[model samples]
Target chain A: MAIEVRVPTILRSYTGGAKVVEGSGDTLSGLIDDLDAKHNGLKGRLITPEGGLHRFVNIYLNDEDVRFLGALDAKVADGDSITILPAVAGGALGFAAAAALLGR
Target chain B: MTPGVPAVGTATPGRAKSHGNVRHVLTIDSAILDAIVAHARRDHPDEACGVVAGPAGSDLPTRLIPMDNAARSMTFYEFDSIEQLRVWREMDDNDEEPVIIYHSHTATEAYPSRTDISFAGEPGAHYLLVSTREPDSTEIRSFRIVDNVVTEEEVNIVDATVDA
Candidate 1:
């Protein structure tokens, strides 16, 4: 299953500066694992130590955000494309206050 | 969809002061600056954010795409994920890149806070800030934030007449 993965500029170092790379898997999680095997340390940037999708990293599968598609368990098929973008977020508030405001 | 500005004559690049490896200057259109300040005031109390896209590698800001601040908090701004995806794809299709990524601070100065530094992901774009704290006055500033370091840059606003 050849899935084309689009890498954002910030994460291009892991792909040897290549913008697009290929991987194989039936699910997004498996695909990432396969990608990490070839790219090395790419998974650590996408997934958190707690085993959840990083809030600051966005993954889309064929125009649908993976978060809305059962996140890591989202199914992927051959020819599907994955686009990863670092979330653009920030503010004047501190992380503690923002976290409290988020009730997390 | 954010409105597209007419393709005006290209303005000369601003004179950047050398600061080691940082180029400390952002040459922008005056009308675009006004639009940014207007958006900040309009969304006062809640932060407003947007991106200004230009030709890839041009570094000249020509398109103003105001993004929805999904967080909608007075002290924070986050581009809605889905909208961001669409906008990014649009840029890619048009052979454009984000030249300026801007946001407003309702209660603080036009400067990046710690959180802003932490979440800044675009190394190639200027991080513009607008302060709407004063009812009668607004402060606009620009910066280059890379590798967890923030360096203030001079904003050179070209008059609308010159561009038209």
Candidate 2:
């Protein structure tokens, strides 16, 4: 089955700065394996040697996180969009700007 | 408005936190965070947010401070300060802090990303992350940015309604 992988803005560097990537994978693991074969450093970042996904990454198959199902090995259907999400912290824009306004 | 942190940061010596510290944090599941992320993904990826509120006593349920995500989705979140102040003031009126400041990782997981750490600088604010790509299976971690050092901790989310 063919799936489209959506990359976050941060990891876009690995995909030649492309936001969206299309590939084929019957299962979620197959999809990632195919992606890593083409993209450098993405495999280490997404999947661990144990075959489980990295702690900071969440793999969504067709808008649903595979972890909620059975995780990395979760099966995928055709036209699935597996989104790889890197864990990010708080977005403290206003606080910083406020501090700056306060001259801190 | 950063929340999910104990005001106890400054109540002690050495333990007191400084601003911009995203490391002194506690982590929680990202299920609740997903609600916020989904909200942002639905209407405006740029500006779609909310507020969280709880009762004055323990018996009440913790509520979300859902607000308008009107700021540019450029790594950081922007809210109406007056509205935030009002929420906090109301919290003060209720005798509880918001306890969580959250935003979405539209294409990422529910962890503190570089941009999130760069922007995270609240003294007693615990950073909460919502991953849009991974719904329900989210991660929430708390942090304290003290003089540029980010300290993290784990916050057990017993129920999707309240934080521990």
Candidate 3:
């Protein structure tokens, strides 16, 4: 059995709108590379140019966050499932409009 | 009203064609809105964040899940990664989607800041903003942030009902 990867809406375009795709690898990084071979550009969205997981992306292996594990080095099994979600974040500061509103 | 997210009463279940074009006006329960405002007040001076989950493709927010701001800063708000994972999984198991992703501004108005626009990833979810800047009255607004573009939407608060 191949590893199953779940794609979130933002990155579905690379998967041809497929929510789940299959690939084979022994490690998380390898799995990503295998998937990228077919999806192309999917790796770049999940991994930064520095070869680390993107800060704005969250990858969970089964029910565990890979970040808390070994991240790219995390182990992957044939039946494992990977879920990729875009980080939900934001703020009200660090902007010219906000700074002006603050009278700064 | 946009094609994907037409005005209220025009959307049908299981017809959510696209994320960014999901909904136009937010028809929310008043009690839920009050709870969100209260959460913002309680977390004043620090940005509060949460999500409202609804049935998949329903665009109706029925479950409110308040999240811990990992940043815990007055200017920034981020969902705790672990918490986000758990909540998202729960939503997934329940076949629900994040209908409303809400956050608070301690000092600024109830609007999407440039930072907010930059980080908006859920094109289908309504971005709800609550400003607790003024202690006497709170300002709340809704917006659709898709592709770095922000469009303000109307907020229609209605009483909670058993059928809703």
* Fnat per model, in the order shown: 0.77, 0.23, 0.68
CA error at residue B62 for candidate 2, angstroms: 1.7
List runs of model 3 lying over 4 Å from the truth: A95-104, B1-22, B161-164
How do the residues B84-134 of candidate 2 rate in per-residue lDDT, one tens digit apiece? 445545766777644456666555555565545654433345555555554
Q: Where is model 2 chain A poorest over a 10-residue stretch in terms of lDDT?
A: A86-95
| Residue pairs with clashing backbones, model 3 | none
Q: What would the per-residue lDDT of candidate 1 be over residues B56-130, giving only the tens digit for each residue?
A: 877788899999999888988888889999999999999998989999999999989988887777888899999
Judge the docking of candidate 2 as incorrect, acceptable, medium or high.
incorrect
State candidate 1's TM-score.
0.88
User: TM-score rank, highest first?
Assistant: 1, 3, 2
Docking class of 3: medium
| Model 3 / residue B157 / CA error / Å | 1.1
Q: How close is candidate 2 to the true structure, as a TM-score?
A: 0.41
Candidate 3: residue A40 Cα off by (Å): 2.0
In order, what DockQ does each candidate have?
0.78, 0.09, 0.50
lDDT of 1: 0.86
As a whole number from 0 to 100, the lDDT of residue A36 in candidate 2 is 83
Give the number of the best model, judged by DockQ. 1
TM-score of chain B of each: 0.85, 0.57, 0.86
